[model samples]
Target: MKTLLTITLTSLLTFNIAFAQTPEERGLEIAIESDKRDTGFADQLAEMLMTLRNAAGKESIRKVRVKTLEVSGDGDKSISIFDQPRDVKGTALLSYTHSTKPDDQWLFLPALKRVKRIASRNKSGPFMGSEFSFEDITSFEVDKYTYKYLRDEEVEGKATFVIEQFPTYQASGYTRRIVWVDQEIYQPLKVEFFDRKNSLLKTLTFHDYQQYLDQYWRADRQEMVNHQSKKSTTLLFNNYQFKTGLTDRDFDQNSLKRAR
Candidate 1:
């Protein structure tokens, strides 16, 4: 009877030990596991940003600036500008995407006679003379990449999910990318970029996140560095407003020329 009781006690202890997990450990697990399921936070995030509409009851403005550089490998050189609100009061610079195809671009430069069109076909050329190709800038949308969970680790004191995102678009210059996302905020902290040859090309870091409208989060600054060239670009976001009555007409090509 003593031997049987001892055996039963051992079995119960084993079961409890296997089932028990601390809250932090559980949170970590959930955080990591969530990355493995369909639609990673990266995709969700991009979709959220793209689909975001100006809220009806809010009035606000956003300001943005993009600075570009040309690396040693390419002879192509150019700078582009864009603005939003399609009016004079608000100056929300939208995007400065670079390409070889006449540097496909639209600018709202108040000084210019009209919104200029960029039509260059150097698709494979480096952007701003940096290691990053033009394809990188035009790829802010979420549907461009497919994701998979790699592992979990701590980054800057917070448990994080390290996920690998593969580009789905045919025109992309990258083969894959690894991103680190904070478990609590679901915000991407860092990204490792890989070229078409599957080699490390660059690194991107996001910082200074601030909450807006109690539910929305925005990164105040973002920096991207080329591993090979040692050159980088830093983007700053200022005066961001949500639900600010933006319309489809605002994104129109004809409106570009008239933008302030």
Candidate 2:
């Protein structure tokens, strides 16, 4: 019976090994899968209406046109140009997000007739007085953060995987972000941002997602609420056109000045 005992013990050891995945590994796997689902759309063009609400309930609106170009082996490049609101008209922001390095960003102020490079240390600041920070607008790259699987839950009747990710880059204002990723579309349904002190700072929720190119999903509306400041911003996207043949030259600093 010694051979039978050896075989049973070996089987038990194999079973244990098969089920030994840590939370970190599972979280990374989920992120990789999510990133994989929405790849290979050469470029995109869209328009957005940003509504900003202050603590006192005052409202301001900004109209913007967006262009994005996909890059292989790296993150995407995008530019946002303000079209309306006389004060901010002709202003633009260009971002070149990287997978493992600090993102390159530039802001062109029409009033000043110049382009200013955004410093990595200041990425956490709000973008044009909106609740969404500069870092928040950058393209999501899996390598930017370390992940931990939290739990499975349902968001708005859709099943989701909850995960916490800590930024691995420098000068990040957030300590951790909890993301609720929709199981069906493999996209983020909601995200909670925690400040450096580990306090809940803000929450961003996605709404009204529409599928494009038969495979890509895009959120038509996104709302961000700041808990401490009692401020909020809502972004409504429209006219999403894919494969617009955008090039790197369209995202450069020089392009920012000519965005108008």
Q: Which model scores highest in lDDT?
A: 2
* TM-scores vs. true structure, each candidate: 0.56, 0.91
Backbone-clash count (model 2): 0
Model 2 clashing residue pairs (backbone): none
Can you write out model 1's per-residue Cα lDDT over 1-260, one digit (the tens) per residue? 99999999999999887678544354445444443331211211111011111223222322323322222222212223333334533221223333222234554446545554444344446643443466654433344456666778898887887878776555566788888877777777888988888999888888888876565555777767767655566555665554444444454555555443
Please report, in order, the local distance difference test score of every candidate based on alpha carbons: 0.52, 0.90
Question: Could you say which candidate leads in TM-score?
Answer: 2
Indicate the residue-level lDDT of 115 in model 1. 53
Candidate 2 residue-wise lDDT, 73-186, digit = tens: 887998988887887888898888886677888889888899998775766888778999877877777888899999999999999999999998777889999999999998
